[model samples]
Target: MPRHVAIIMDGNGRWAKQRHLPRAMGHRRGVEAVREIVRAAGDMGLEALTLYAFSSENWKRPAQEVGDLMGLLKHFIVADIDEFVENGVRLKVIGRYRELAPDIVALIDDAVARTSENSRTTLAVALNYGAQDELVRATSAIAARVAEGSLAPADIDTDAFADALDTADMPPLDLLIRTSGEQRLSNFLLWQCAYAELWFTDTLWPDFSRAHFAQALAEYAARERRFGGR
Candidate 1:
């Protein structure tokens, strides 16, 4: 089984449009997909699951839509916290958390703290996350350390860079799935997905089911993960 599975959840708005429903409705339905996939991943013995919930660029969206997303996230916290614990799923967030509203940050912190002890599966949500920002932040941290005489520039290496990332505690990605017919990473996991298998599908986020997830896993199982080997 794959140790870590990362997903770029896309097509919520488009899915809603196709059904003549408001985009908020699609986002609401997409939340359910998150629940299903989290359980499906746990049942499949995956140790870590990382989801691209909101990107740094998502701020370009309209104000109302962004507000709705933030509100939906709060609702997700209220609804999923107990279920996360009941399912032995650990909740974690990796992103530029300081940029979020205080209330949302508090909710996320509470969720992370409450589920810290769960051992069966780990669910990591990437909120306000962007790979480029993570790299820039890490670089700034390294520069500060060097300026403080606390570290030497030559000491930096791949592991050093990895340690500086927000996802330092999580396992490296084994597989990356992008749904909604998208075929790009869009600047995710720049430092961690060194050798992850990639899967893309036309299935939109709101309509993404466990069967689609399973198909991605099945495809992953069929590949040769040489990690640059012959």
Candidate 2:
């Protein structure tokens, strides 16, 4: 019953390596996992699911690989948008979307618009996102407001600062899952995950099944989240 769950879909490259398949093939397969997870989350009555689709540092990868990733994104949008709209699933693309290719940006805008009124579920895809960069950007916005006399420096607090972050509209993060047995956050939703339960698994992104997701939720359900209290 996590109100909001975020996942770092890791191990695409490693999965590809293990199978002697091209890296792009792994990325393509990862999209199938995304579809499965989104469906599972909605069926489970989850409020929101935020996926770390691409990070800011991912641009450091090879040009062909990046191109392949973008191509896969485009393919997913085109192939699944109709189903998303029909199922009442809202699609949100967060992070530096303006930096993407114009066509991709247009597709994202279209998908978001088409599902704007959906209430069944919310699926947020974080592309070109970085936690530190998001924090810096939020701080800069708050500073600008203070300098403009629209806000007082003394009024800044955790809630006020969180409002400046990108996830202000979404529910507070309740669970964070990292696949491929990774245990690090990797610059994803740092502000929102302050109190989220953490889960890790060795299943690669392409291999992550609904059973694995259910197991993560089961483990989360067994925890006692007292916030700061004992």
Candidate 3:
């Protein structure tokens, strides 16, 4: 089995439009899907699962929608944190998550602290995340170290750069799945997924199930990863 898998949960808005329901309703259902998938990943013995929860660019959306998304996130953490601890799932948040609302940040910090020792699986959620922004931040930090004479320019390498990323402690990404038939990465985990196999499905976020996840894994098992070697 692939040691790590990440997902771009898309199509909640489209799903809601298709069903003649409010977008908030779709997001609510999407949260349910998140719960199912996390449970499934743990049961299947995956080492890590990273979810693209919210992107930095998402701030351009309407104020009310953004507020709704924040509310949903707060609810998810409050409602599911117990289950996470019970199932041995460690909670890790990436990107500028601390820039979120103060109360939300506190809740996230509490949840992360509460589940820090779990070993069964790691669930990394990318909140206020953007690959380009992450890269810039990482680069800026490394440059600062160089300026301070604490690091040499010649010492920079892929490993050194990766160590500065938010996912530095997580397992190397092995498979990336994008739902809702989207075939693009959407600026999610660009650095971490450099060599990961890509999978896309027509299933929307709210409709994604364990079966779909299993199918992706089965396909991953059948393929050969060259990793730039013949």
Candidate 4:
């Protein structure tokens, strides 16, 4: 099985619109899908599952929508943290997540601390995340170290650069799945998924189930990874 997998949960609003429901309803349903997928990932023995929860660019969305998203995030943490601890799933947040609302940040910190010791699986959520922003931050840190004479310019290799990323401690990405028929990365995990297999499905985020997830894994198993070698 692929050790690490990440997903771009798209089409929540579209799903709601299609059903003549409010966007918030779609997001709520999407959270339910998140719960199911996290459990499936742990049951399948995946080392890590990273979810693109919110991107830095998402701030441009309507204020009400953004607020609702934050509320859902808080609710998800409060509601699901116990299960995470019980199931041995470690909670991790990537990107500039600390920039979120103070209360939300506090909740995330508490949840992360509460589940820090779990070893079975890592659930990494990307909040306020953007691959380009992540890369810039990582590069800036590396440059600062070089300026301080603590690191040499010649030492900046792929491994060194990767170590500066927010996902440095997580397993290498082995597969990346995007739902809602979206075929683009949308600025998610550009660095980590460099060699990961890509999978896209028309199923919307709220409609994504364990069966769809299983199909992706089965397809992954049948493929050969060349990793730049024949």
Best by lDDT: 4
lDDT of 2 by residue, 107-225 (tens): 99999999999998999999989999999999999999999999998999998899998888899999999999889999899888888999999999999999999999999999999
RMSD of each: 1.2, 0.8, 0.8, 0.6
**TM-score per candidate:** 0.96, 0.98, 0.98, 0.99
* Model 1 lDDT tens row, 1-230: 68999999999999999999999999999999998999999999999999999999999999999999999999999888999989898998988876899999999899989999999999989999999999999999888988999889899888888888888888888999999998989999987888999999999988889999999999999998998887
Model 2 ranges off by over 4 Å: none
Model 1, C-alpha of 102: deviation from truth (Å): 1.4
Superior candidate under TM-score, 1 versus 4: 4
User: Which lDDT tens digits does candidate 3 get at residues 1-230?
Assistant: 99999999999999999999999999999999999999999999999999999999999999998999999999999999999999999999999999999999999999999999999999999999999999999999899989999889999999989989999999999999999998999899889888999999999999999999999999999999999888
Tell me which of candidates 1 and 2 scores higher on lDDT: 2
Off by over 4 Å in 3: none
Candidate 2 clashing pairs, residues 3+ apart or interchain: none
Supply candidate 3's per-residue lDDT for 212. Answer: 96
User: In model 1, how many backbone clashes occur?
Assistant: 0
Q: Candidate 1: deviation at residue 174, Å?
A: 0.7
